[model samples]
Target: GAGVSQSPRYKVAKRGQDVALRCDPISGHVSLFWYQQALGQGPEFLTYFQNEAQLDKSGLPSDRFFAERPEGSVSTLKIQRTQQEDSAVYLCASSKTTGPGYTFGSGTRLTVV
Candidate 1:
């Protein structure tokens, strides 16, 4: 892809339901990441993967959240038993290095009701 792509730019899930968001990062990028952004708040890192290796997942709010990048290109984030507090924008970003800038997708706005 020419740029990162995230599906279902908007999602509405009833409480206790599960939701899976998808991301397609820039072609050939080595590093991919997921972040959660609550209303009026900055994005917080959720997980990071480097070429199919999940290097970090310390920021995931709970075990209910999971992310994977099997082929090191496209990724998915699954959240189980969604709650109202789970409403937020799920952002995906990819970078060649851990360094400065990162290209981010528009994000999937998940709204739990």
Candidate 2:
């Protein structure tokens, strides 16, 4: 992909179902980040990756939240035991080694019902 790409732009999950969101970054991009944006609030960083190594995940709210970028170009965010409070727009971004700005993908709107 020439830019960051996310799939299933909208998702609706039953209360206990788990969901996996995918992100494909631009070719050669070295940095990737995941964020969760709640309604009426700014995006909150969830995790960051430099190439295939996950550098930070301190912002992940709970053990059920997980993110990974393996082989360096693509990533996935998985949430277990979906809950209403977890509903938010999950955003994925990529940059060139800490570039001042990132190219963000159209977020995946997750709705837990």
Across residues 64-86, which tens digit of lDDT does each residue of candidate 2 receive? 99998889989999999999999
What's model 1's lDDT at 24? 94
- C-alpha lDDT (0 to 100) for residue 54 of candidate 2: 95
- On the 0 to 100 scale, the lDDT of residue 34 in model 1 is 95
Cα distance off (Å), candidate 2, residue 100: 3.5
> Residue 32: error of model 1 in Å?
0.4
- Candidate 1 TM-score to native: 0.97
User: How does residue 33 of candidate 1 score in lDDT?
Assistant: 92
Clashing pairs in 1: none
lDDT by residue for model 1 (1-113), tens: 78899998999999999999999999888889999999999999999999899999999999999999988889999999999999999999999777548899999999998
Model 2: residues >4 Å from true position, as ranges?
none
